[model samples]
Target: MRIAVAQMCSGISPIDNARVLQNYIGDAAAQKAEILFTPEMTGLVDRDRARAMAHIYPESEDPVLAAACAAAKHAQIWVALGSLAIQPIESGSEKSVNRSFLINPVGDIVARYDKIHLFDVDLDSGESWRESSAYQGGTQAVTARFGETVLGLSVCYDLRFPALYAGLTNAGAEILAIPAAFTVPTGKAHWEILLRARAIEAGVFVVAAAQCGAHEDGRKTYGHSLIVDPWGQVLLDMDTEIGVAVCDINLQEVAKTRRRIPAIANRRTFALPKDFG
Candidate 1:
């Protein structure tokens, strides 16, 4: 199937972001792409944490989500909305969930995955983020099947956890979607390396759409969206811009690679070492 990875520099307006995404989706459909994916914060990217909290709403009331569903129906292509800030059920507390949605061509939500790993890091460049302070982590892993291909869903910081990818592959995932708004520092250092590693380890195609350039909040993102084949080869890449890339993927590669390596079948459980007095 032909897939398109969309890279964007999202600002702090869901309406404007949706408009940009609509244009990109149209472009992808024009190129005959069967599936299209966008980066994290597809709805909006707000540097002001308080503003983000105030603007977040339940998924049912999110206009961006509704518009994306409509867009999917119009394009007749599966769309993986990277991630959106959604207000979770809370009693007198302000907490939201970083949620990702997979929409079918008919405008049906096929799967939803909340971000399990919240970015909580102190960068050496004086950029410190504590995502968990405002958002709650998800507890479940999700996968969806599109015809003959199985897709694994994950958000930004989840990429750091290899076991999640392993679990997805074990659950029969042939393609993995990693939608991210990776910081410039971390992305420059580890983005491609980690993506290639995951593809090689899982023996699955890795489609990573990323946020690029600087946002309205003075925060910069690393924007090298990529599609890596089972052989750890980058099939398509969008470097530092609002752009789209199309590539053809074959599911047969997953079987071929698994048969050649057979590593997943060889996995054995081991106990941790004890060092008690």
Candidate 2:
């Protein structure tokens, strides 16, 4: 099947972001893509944690979510609406969840996966992020079927946790989707490496759509959106632009790679060695 990964530069306005996404979706559809994917923070990117929290709403009330569903139905292609900030159900709290929606071609939400890993770190560049301060962490890993392929869902920080990918692979996922808005420092250093490693380890196809360039919040992102095959080969990559990378993926490759390596089946559970002291 032909798949397209969209790299975007999102700002603070959901309307504007949705328009950009609409155009890209149209382009991908014109190219006969069966499935399309977008990056994290697909609706909006606000550096002000408080403002972002205030803007959150239930999925039904979110304009971007509604628009994306309509677009998916119009395009007749399955779409992964990377991640959006969603208001929590709890009352009297300012917490939200970073959630991804899997929309079928009929514009129905088939499955949802909230970002499991929150990025809470103090960077060496004097930039500290406490993602948990504003966003509630998700507890489940999810996968959905698109044609004959089972696609696993994951978001930005979740890429750092190998166990998540392993779980997805074990759950019969043939393709893994990682949509991210990674900081420049981390993206440059570990983005490709981690993605390739995950693909190689799981012996599954990996599609990563990402955000790039600077946002209105004065934060920069590394935009190297990539699509890697089961053998850890990059099929297409977009470097710092609002564009789409198109590639043809054959599901048979997944089985072939796994048969050649068989690492997933060879996994062993063992206790750590005793300490010397």
Candidate 3:
């Protein structure tokens, strides 16, 4: 299967971001890609909560999401729309939800996965973030069937948690989608290593579409969108580029790699230690 990843620097305006996505969708389709994977916060990226709140809408009402669906339908391609910033479904909630949508060729949403891990960090470079303050985390891990393959869903911070990937693979997911908007400090150090580890251990294909370059919100993102095969091979890496990277992958490799490793089948449970001291 031929898949495309869109590496873009999202701005604070949802409307502008929508236009970028539409172009990428058309570009991916023109290349005969089956699906297009995009980065997290594809709709809006704003540091000012007060300003962003006005743009965030419920899933049914979000214009960016609507545009993406329509574009996908028009192009006759599937879209793994990395993540969107949208209003939380809970009526009285003030925070929004970081949500991922899987759209079929007909432009219908087949699955939705809210980001389970909210990024909270204080970097040595004096960069601090409290993602939970602006968005509530999702409790469920998500996977969806796409033709002959099954896809495991996750977002930026979720990539750090390996057990989630384990469970997804155990549930019969052959490919893992880990869309991200990582910081420059961490992305350079741990991004590729972690992705390679995940693919190697899970024996699954890992696709990570990422946000790259400086944004209108005054923050910079590390852009190295990657596609790793089950054997931990880096198929394509769009290093700090604002464009689409396409690669053809074979689903049969998933089975071949798993059979050779047999680690997933060999996994066993053990008791934890009683003391932390």
Error of 1 at 199 (Å): 0.5
Residue lDDT tens for model 2, 151-171: 999998899899999999999
Candidate 3: Cα lDDT at 169: 91
Task: Go through the candidates in order and give the clash count of each.
Answer: 0, 0, 0
Q: Model 3, residue 21: displacement in angstroms?
A: 0.4
lDDT of each: 0.89, 0.90, 0.93
Segments of candidate 1 deviating more than 4 angstroms: 90-93
Positional deviation of residue 197's Cα in model 3 after best superposition, in angstroms: 0.6
- Sort every candidate by TM-score, greatest first: 3, 1, 2
Candidate 2 ranges beyond 4 A from true positions: 90-93, 272-277
What is candidate 2's CA lDDT for residue 66?
87
lDDT of 2 at 223: 94
RMSD of 2: 1.7
Residue 82 C-alpha lDDT in model 3: 97
